[model samples]
Target: MTAAVTTEHREHYLALVGHGDEAAAVDYALGLAECGVSPRDLVLDLIGPTQRRIGDLWARDEWSVAQEHAATHVSEQVVAALAARHRPRPDRGVVVVACVDGEWHALPARLFAEVIRWDGWDVRFLGASVPGPHLVSYLHRHGPDVVAVSCSVPTRLTSAHRVIQAVQDVGVPVLAGGGGFGPGARWGTKLGADRVAADGRAALEVLRSWPLRAVAEVSPLRDSFVSDDEHVLVVKRGAQLVAVAMDRLADRFPAVHGYTAAQREATEYDLGQIVEFLCAGLFVDDVELFRAFVSWLCVVLASRRVPPETVDLVLDVYHDELFDFPRARAHLVAGRRQVPAGRQVAA
Candidate 1:
């Protein structure tokens, strides 16, 4: 059937990926393609959702990081196998798909590239974490009709904004995609994309109807940046803030002192992530962004058996440290509420 990969197919394919069965997964996908499931549907409906499920499983602690990575590798292989099997004519214009600088998640961008290729566009995938000047130079030489910037995490929005600015500067229409753009791609509009496509299908819709070479001739929205510049100031204190939180962590949460090397590393990462997410919310002037991230982080830490008080302590330390910056302090307070059974950190 030419229909989307049904639940039956998804479960079957996931089993292969879950077991790290790359050959079986690829063969199964190729079989589906040969049996009439279109390439776009195969990627969007099957591989895409499977990748997400892999993330969910990891966040829930059902899958180890190694397992998650293995499944992801298999999924990548399936995408490549499918691409090699179904070649599309690029009657449409050239499109370059790349992850924003500092964003290492390349699979989503690769998936999008393949989906658009099926739509008859010649897509040049730049893999993950493309730096600014490099991307701009490529735009100059390649002169693509559109450049799709992918950022999977909110922490990358600032990087995404820089890439969007660079692409627009080079006169290439910028299309912002992925979770970094926030709900309804509001942050994408804030960053000044010619258009925002949530996924590859929406990208095709916009690209197909996009006016003739709009990137070369028009700017869809004016460039945007933080008005108050508080985020700029707060970002500079990243290391100092992390050190203070870690320094004070043992006062309330003594368990951290006894952590093994891996646990300590993970704990440090979790602490750093809080600052990154807070800065991201500050960049966009949206407190809810930080709140959502805090909630998600709480769940993730809880799954790993981390006590909620550890978060409370960090937020308290950050709140006190960022006292001079009103917006940063407010975002910290908002994030603190999301921690389960959280206590206010006294200044």
Candidate 2:
């Protein structure tokens, strides 16, 4: 039987929020509405709080990618249904919401758009991965009153500055907000942004104030340590695109020289002097493998309760599979270090 949408629904909503369960969140919202919870209260108390919980869970690593997607989807549905139920307010102007190029995370933007819409402002959700030129064209054509740009990763911050320039060129005020701006309150200021909201609700409050002006002067792009080395492989994992430096791998793991020519030719591990490598899909690149291997070695060195079978398994499989593993292990043993037994080592 389906669970009744009662005060009990709040608990389920909380779970959906914490885990990013979209479908369950929608159902919870429906129940809350049936139980006579006003949309205004639902937005302020339920939806807002739920997003905060999702952020917390993400920080704690308690939620998976699937869970976060589910939560975001359900929250979107809730916003849509609520908007349909409420008559449009005539007072406020339109907002153009987007993420900067290379910044593909959009849940925060979507959530803020909904909250602003609920507060009587019209919103144009540009979704994720919007290019700067496209946004400039969009602003030129549509002429939204406010532009909201989000970037969760610090890596894409340089691209974000370009987005700000594009929007400002079209004479629209921009509201920049998200995880990236929280650490340094001066982040937006440094970027020459009009206003920086601490969060979604704070953004809404800033927009409502109306008197806040966006700076007109253009700013230079922020510094990026990410180099254009071809040996550098960039891989996207959710909102972050981690860059791996493979150029220094050989010096770090000189035992790689011990591999047979056949082994060297067959495995990607032998791409000598690799500057960058990506960690895309299921398989990890050589950089991540090395990092994981080192961390595993650390745990084995520290933990005493590891099983003998696990240690034997590591010696049998990894020692044979990796050309450098045997030499590395020998080095560790020579240092009088004891390795722990384990099935899978944490990285």
Candidate 3:
């Protein structure tokens, strides 16, 4: 294809996203394939940007659940049709895409398959929620050049880690991706995975030239806004949580002490453990008091310069006590007094 034709085809793909026209996107991808456009080019030039836009639309609330589902279905059809025309290349190395046991989000994995296919790889996509035994059996059977796992929820991390360990046991390298591996996202390294890709394009680039032999120098997964996990802090409001790594939370809580250390241990359930301890001082089942206590932990104990051992002591004391609303409310009030009156509440 001429440069102009390729560019025009790519633009058509982008236009589909701009208009939220999944059908148009499908037609464009098919048109590129029929016109003898390289699958790699189609993926690198078209599908990557298109999927990013789709994610952005969802993020911005510009696309409803139905619309997002429709878009994903359309993209899947397009990739399936294209794959039917091109068989996996023998020399491009083996790749398998699977979702962790509990994550139903397969669009990311689908887009990635299209990407590796475009890169001339031999890809076997296991779709959403393939169990650990199946994954192990498949890895033992195929011994792919790389294994790419998608996990979209933090709740699924335990399962995802299990999958990674299972795959690694067979000597397969695993690359962990998806929204779950965000800034301050924990357990990626502890799960013993090889690498984590922050975005789709970055993932494709890394896998293409990745070494067959493992690189002994393992490092933390880099995030969009933060590269270092030690600097990220996670804030939990009861069951809801948000994580900010790389000193971003520091700017948000200027008056809070020990922000650095708090950032270091801010993993999922870690805050919950802290909350349980702090709640001991408060009344149980009191939502308002609990929220206030969480806020206090974030701003006071978490923000200030409390020693890690001291903070651990506080959490140890309150890990499990009956609801004491009046006492908890009093502690909340005292905590609030330490901060400026008009600060924003923690999530």
How well does candidate 3 score on lDDT at residue 186?
33
Number of backbone-clashing residue pairs for each candidate, in the order shown: 0, 15, 13
In candidate 1, the residue pairs with backbone N, CA or C atoms under 3 Å apart (3 or more residues apart, or in different chains) clash, namely none
Error of 3 at 13 (Å): 3.9
What RMSD, rounded to one decimal, does every model reach?
1.9, 11.2, 13.3
- Model 2: weakest 10-residue lDDT segment is 273-282
Where does model 2 exceed 4 Å of error? 1-11, 16-24, 34-41, 48-52, 55-61, 212-347
Error of 1 at 168 (Å): 0.9
Question: lDDT tens string, model 1, 1-347?
Answer: 46568999999998999999999999999889888899899999999999988888899899999999999999999999989988977898889999999999899989999998988889999999999999999989999988989999999998898898888887788888987888877788877787897777887788889974644545446564545788878889988998898889866777768889997787678788888899899998999999999898888888988788888888888898888998898888888888999975432
Q: How accurate locally, in lDDT, is each candidate?
A: 0.86, 0.56, 0.58
Best of the candidates, TM-score: 1
Q: Model 3: runs farther than 4 Å from truth? A: 1-24, 33-37, 183-190, 213-342, 345-347
lDDT of 2 by residue, 1-347 (tens): 22233445556687765566556667767666767776756775676666666655654456665776677677767877776776567468888889888777776677677778778887788999898888888888898887888877544555766787767777787778876543433456556677788766677677887653444432343222232322122222211211111212234456546758775453233121110111210111123323333344444323434334433333333323333333323322322223333344322
**What TM-score should be assigned to candidate 3?**
0.56
Please, what is the TM-score per model? 0.95, 0.58, 0.56
Ranking by lDDT: 1, 3, 2
